[model samples]
Target: MLNLLSGFIGLVALILMIPAVIPLLGALNWLFVPLALLGAFIGMLSSKKGGQNFCLIVAAFGALRLFLGGGII
Candidate 1:
């Protein structure tokens, strides 16, 4: 159940992240990173690795975008 929830949230974050990758829109990642982190935290409470791994990868991408944009773009 928790894993399912985490996966869903991660999917949503991934969807939102798509636009944030734009050169001038990278600031959106500020919102995405925390959401992804929440999903990751929830995934961590679950018993499986799938959801956790998914959320972690999403969060990593978000963080990378933020870093590339210098925290604001």
Candidate 2:
């Protein structure tokens, strides 16, 4: 489960980095790619709480992009 989740996280981050700019947001989308990879590793290697924490981080960032609206520039 950990490995699968980690891979998925990285994949999602990479995909998000593909678009080119938006009306309201900026180019901060690609930044989450590395972050997601790191979080995935942390989630796979650390304690249960640590994994949860990483997942929370990923979720929060994703939420920010979706809710607040951010773009790739």
Candidate 3:
């Protein structure tokens, strides 16, 4: 149950990031990145294979966005 919830959260975060890619919504990335991280953390804590995979993907994309946006150095 927790695993499913965590995976769903990660998937939702990824979906939210789509709009953030647009110039008008670019600033939204800041919000989405944290959301993604939260989802990833929750998923990790769930300790389920499916949740872990979802979290990994979300984390990777979030990190890439942060790096590209100069949030990370």
User: lDDT winner among the candidates?
Assistant: 1
Q: Is candidate 1 or candidate 2 better by TM-score?
A: 1
Per-candidate local distance difference test: 0.93, 0.54, 0.72
Per-residue lDDT over 1-73 for candidate 3, one digit per residue giving the tens place of the 0 to 100 score: 7688878888888888887665555567677767767776777777576876776787678667766767632
TM-score of each: 0.95, 0.40, 0.74
Instruction: State the lDDT at 33 in candidate 2.
Output: 42
After superposition on all C-alphas, the RMSD of every candidate to the true structure, in Å, is 0.7, 7.3, 2.8
Which scores greater on lDDT, model 2 or model 3? 3
Candidate 1: pairs in clash? none
Q: Which ten-residue region of model 3 has the weakest summed lDDT?
A: 20-29
lDDT score at residue 47, model 1, on the 0-100 scale: 97
Model 3 TM: 0.74
